[model samples]
Target chain A: GFAELLREWESLENEYQNTQETHQLYRQKLEEVSKLQESCVAAITRQRKRLKDMSPSIRKCKQTMTSEEANTMEEIQALIKERPNIFFEMEAFLPKKNGLYLRLVLGNVDITLLSKQSKFAYKDEYETFKLFITVILLLFAFTCQFLVSNRIVDVLFNFLLVWYYATLTIRESILISNGSRIKGWWVFHHYVSAVLSGVMLTWPNGKLYQMFRNQFLAYSFYQNFVHLLQYYYQSGCLYRLRALGERHNMDLTVAGFQSWMWRGLTFLLPFLFFGHFWQLYNGLCLFRMSQLPECTEWQVVMCGSSFLVLFMGNFFTTLTVVYHKFKK
Target chain B: GFAELLREWESLENEYQNTQETHQLYRQKLEEVSKLQESCVAAITRQRKRLKDMSPSIRKCKQTMTSEEANTMEEIQALIKERPNIFFEMEAFLPKKNGLYLRLVLGNVDITLLSKQSKFAYKDEYETFKLFITVILLLFAFTCQFLVSNRIVDVLFNFLLVWYYATLTIRESILISNGSRIKGWWVFHHYVSAVLSGVMLTWPNGKLYQMFRNQFLAYSFYQNFVHLLQYYYQSGCLYRLRALGERHNMDLTVAGFQSWMWRGLTFLLPFLFFGHFWQLYNGLCLFRMSQLPECTEWQVVMCGSSFLVLFMGNFFTTLTVVYHKFKK
Candidate 1:
C-alpha cells in the first residue's frame, strides 16, 4: 500500500505540474492575440450584425457567378461588415484623449501582407520511427501486457503512448492545415485520435507538451523507411525468379526496415512506462509504508483512495485501451 | 479557488518509478505478422444487412453471376467497405505500434529516401538564415526560459517568451527531427505578428501538434507590455492603438527577442509557475476576482480543454479513418 501510494503520488504530481504549466502558457499566448475591448462591445456587435444581413445570398443567380468567386466575395463582404464593428471595438478601449490625432492616423492604415514571410515547421525522426514501431509493438505489447499485467510494463508503454500521441496530434494538425479531410467516415479517421492526447497530456508542467514536440531527426529514419517499404512493395521485392518480370532496381529496404524498427519502439513504451511506474510504486511503497511511525488512519485511507483513483482513472484507462487493442 | 480545484488535481507523489526495462526488446522486433487476424464484427453485420435486402434488385444481381463469383464479389465489396474502418481504428493504436509510418520504400529494399532525411537542408540561403538566427537561439535556452522575469523593461518586452517556447517544446522536438513551420499573424496597426518557424519538421512529430500544444514558454513579453500600458488605456493595449498596422516587422522582432538572464541561475520553475499564479491570484482578488483572471483564463482554459478532448478522442476516430483512406 505504501509503495502504491508513492507511485500514485508521483504520477499525480507529475501530471498536475504538467497541466498547470500548459494552462498558464495557453492563457498568456491567447492573451497576446486577443483584440477584445469592453467599451465598443455593444456598438461593434450591432453594426457588424447589421452589415452581415446585407450580404449576398449563397445560392447566387446561378446566373453569372462561380461558387468559388461567390465564396470569395462572401468572405470579403463578411470582413467588410465586420470592419466597422471591428474598428469600433478597437476604438472603445482607446483613451478618449490619446494622441487623438495620432489615433486617427493609425486607425485608417491597411496592414495585410502581400506575401507570407515564412511557415513554421518542426521535425522528429525518432518519434516517426517510434510511432511506427509503437503501432506494430502496441499490437504485440497489447497482448503481452494483457498476459502479464505488470504495472511497470504499463508505465513504460503508457508514457510512450502519451508521447506517441503528442507526435500524432502535431502531425494531424499540420495535415488539417494542408486539407486532410474525409467525406463522412470514409476519411475522417485523422481528426478523432488527437482528442485522446488532448486529454491524456493535459497536465500542469507541460512535460507531455515538451515530450509531444517534433523530433524530426529521429523521425527522418521513419519517413525514409516508410517510403522505401512502400516503394519496395509496389516494385515487388528482389525475386530474380526466371520469367517473373523485366526487373528494375528494387530499393525497398528503408521502409520495411523502418517499419520493423518503428513498430518495435512503439509497443515498447507501454512496457517501459508501466515497468517504471511499478518499480517506483513498489519499492517506494514497501520501503516507506513499512516504516511509518505515526500516521493517522484517515491519512492512510485518503492515500489509498487516491491510489485507487489514479490506477482506475489513468493507468486502467491506458491498460484497458491497450488491452482491447491487442485483443483485437 | 473552487474552480481551480476542479481545473486540476495536485498529485501527492513527486517521483516516478523506472519500470521501462522488463520487456525483451527482441520479441517486439521478431513478431512476424503472418495471417492477420481481424474481428468479424463487420462481416456479421454485413450478412445481416444482405439477408434483409431481399428486394427485386438484389434478386436480379444474384441471378447474373455464379454463386462462387457472387460470393467473391461480396467479399471484395465488404473488404472495400471495411478498408477505411481498419486504417482509422488502427491509427489510434499506431503510436504504440511503432511510429509514424512515413518512410518511402525504394525498389530492391536497399535504398530509402525520406523527404525529411535532409535535416536542416543547409543547402539553401533562406534556410541558412533560419538556422543562424531562430534555430541557434532555440538550442541554447529554447524560447528563453533561461531568462527569468525581473527588471520592468525586460518583463515588459517578454524577451524570453520566444526562446522559452522555441526551446522547451518546438525547438527540442525540431532538434529531434529537423522539421518546422514558420508563419505569422498580423495584428492591427501595421503590426505583423508573424507566427513562423523553420521547417515542416518530421512526423514522429509535426507543426500541427506544436500549434495545438499549450505550454508556458517563459515570461510573457506581451503581458508585461500590457501591464505597463494598462494605465495608458483602460482597456489595455488593444484600446491604446488607434489603427494597428500589419506591415512593419517590429512585432516579429519583438516576439523573437528573449532574455534568459536572472539575478542568479535559479531554475525559476516554481517561481515562474506557482509563485506567479499565487501572486496573480492575489492581485486579482484585490480587484473583483473575476476581472483580470477571466480575461485571459478563457483562452488558456479553452486551448487546454480543446487539446485534451481532441487528443483523447481523435485517435480512435483516426484508426478507422486511416484504414479506409489506405484501402481506398
Candidate 2:
C-alpha cells in the first residue's frame, strides 16, 4: 500500500512537470510570433510609404476613373504574376490571413475565367452587363409599382431583388478579390437592403402592406434614381479620365473631378438623407406597433428589427463618409 | 445664294477645328494619366522588394498566429491616427477606397467604445460575453428543440438566428473596421442564412412545412454542432497563441495549429459536403415539385432557389479553401 501511494505521487509530479514544460514551449513560440508580427508591421509600413508617394497619381486616377477597369486589371495582374513577392509584402498590411485568402480564391477563379488578355476585359464586360441588367430590372419594377402595385408585381419585384443583389454580391466579391475598392460596409449595406427587399416582396397584401406601399414605392424610386445617377456620373468620369491617360487612381477627391458630377452628388445628398431618415421612422413605427398584445405573428417584430438594424447601419455609415468628405 | 452657302461651309469648318482641338486636349490628359499609373506601379514594386526582404518574419508570423488579437487595436488605431499617410499609402494596395471608408466608420465607433487602455481589453471582453450569451441561447434552443418542437420553438429559434447573426455581423464589422480580416463573403453568407431562417420560421405549419420539418431540424442540428466545434477550436487556438505574443496573423498552416483541430475539420468536411449536397438536392426536388399545378404558393420556389444559392456558394468557397490548403 505504501509503495502504491509513492508511485501515484511520482506520476502526479511527472504530469505537472510535463504541463509546465508544454506551457514554457508555447510561451517561447509566442515570443517568436510577436517578433515576427513586428517585422510584418514594419514591412507593411515600408510598403505604405511607397503607396503614399503615388498619392498624386492615385488622386488623379480617382478623379477620372469610376471603379476598377480593364486596363487597371491588366496592370494589377501583371504586377502579381511578375512579382508575387509584392503581393506577399503588402499581405502584412491586410486583415488576418485575407491577403493569402484573396490570392488563393482569385487565383483559382482567374485560371478559369481570365484566360489571358480576356481576363482584364472580364470586369469591364461584367460591369457593362450588370448595368444593362440593372437598368432593365429597375425600369420593370418602376412600371409595375406605378401601374399596378398588386401581389404579382410585389412577388416579381421580390424575385428580382433577390436575384439582382445575389448577383451584385457575387460580382462585388470578385471585384474585391481582384483588388477593387468597394468597402466591406458597402457590400454589407447591399446585403441588408437585399434582405429588406426580400421581406417586402414576401409581405402579403394586408392592411399593413397597404399602409406602407406608397412609402416603399417612393423609397425604391429614390434608390433607383440615385443608382442611375451614380452609374452614369462614374462611367462618364472614367471614360474621360481613361482617355486622358489616368489609370488605377480613384481617390474620390474634389480636385480634377468634373464639377458637374460633384454638383450632382451634392444635390442628391439631401434626398438620400431624407430617405434614410424615413426608413428610421418607419422602423420605429413598426417596432412600436409590434409591441402591442394583438400582434399574432412575430414577423412584425422580426421585420421591425431588420428595419432598425438596416437604418442604423446605413445612416451611420453614409453619414460618417459624408461628414469626413465634407470636413476635408 | 452662293454667298450664303460659302458662309455655312466656313462655319462648319470652324466647328470641326474646335472639335479636333478638344480631342487633342483629351489625348494629352490620357497620356498624363497613363504616366501617373506607371509611377504608382513602380512605387508599389519598390515596396514589395522591401517586404520580400522581411519574408522570414512574415512566414514566421504566418505559422504562429490564428488571427487578430485585442492588443493590436491600440497599435492600429495609433497608426491610423498618427500617420494616416501610411494608411493612404497602403490604400493603393487594398481594394479601392476602403482605407478612407474604414477610417471614417471605425474612427467614429472607436471614439464611443474604445477609451484609452480599455480599448485593447474590449475585444477579449466582448468575445467572452458573446460566448457566454451564445452558450446560454444554444442550450435553451437545444432544450426547446429536443423537448418541444412546436410553433413557439420555431419562432424562438428564428428570433435567435436573426438576433445572433445581426449581433455577430455588427461585431464582425467592427472588428473589420478595426483592421480585422474577416472576409466580406462570410458576412454576406450569414445575411443569406438569416433571411433563410426567417423565412422558415414564418412558414405556416402546413403541407410544405410538415414535409421539411425533420430535414430542417437535422440540418439545424448539424449546423449548430459545427458552430460549437469551430468556436472551441478557434477560441482555444487564439488564447494559447496570444499567450505566446502573436497578433494579426492567421495563416492556417499546420505547424503551430493543433493537429486534432485539423483532424476534426478533415473529418467534418465530408459531413459538411454531404449536407451541402443534400441542400442542393432538396432545392432541386422542391423546384421540380413546385412546378406542379397543385403548388399554390411560390414560397416553395423561392425557398428552393435560396437553398441552391446557399449550397453552391458554401460548397465552392469551402472546397476552394480546402483544396488550396491541402494542395500546399
* TM-score of every prediction relative to native: 0.20, 0.41
- lDDT per residue (tens digit) for residues A19-126 in model 2: 344434433543443344445445445444544444444444444553554355345435434333444323322223223322221111121221122223544555
Segments of candidate 1 deviating more than 4 angstroms:
A1-131, A134-136, A139-143, A182-328, B1-167, B171-328
TM-scores of the candidates, chain A only: 0.23, 0.59
Give the TM-score (vs. native) of candidate 1. Answer: 0.20
Candidate 2, residue B137: lDDT:
63
- Mind giving the per-residue lDDT tens digits that candidate 1 earns over A1-328? 3233335435534643443444344334323322222223344445445444433332243245666655655665554644654343243222222132211211111111111110111112323444455455444354433465432333233334434444444343332222223122211222232222222222212222223222211232233344344333322322221123322222354445435434643555455355335423533443354345543122233333333333334444445544653543
Candidate 1 reaches a DockQ of 0.01
- Report the lDDT tens digits of candidate 2 across residue range B96-176: 222332222111111112121232344564456456656766676576557787766665666566556644554555445
lDDT scores of the candidates, listed in order: 0.31, 0.55
DockQ values of all predictions: 0.01, 0.02
lDDT of 2 at B135: 71
Q: On residues B1-328, what C-alpha lDDT tens digit does candidate 1 reach at each position?
A: 2222212211100100011111112112212210011122233334335434423334455566767756754664554465444433322211111112222110011011112222222113222333343333343333334444222222222222322232233322222222222211101100111111111010012232332222323213322332233222222222212133221222423331212111111233223334334334322332342243334222233233322333233333334433642343
The numbered model that scores best in lDDT is 2
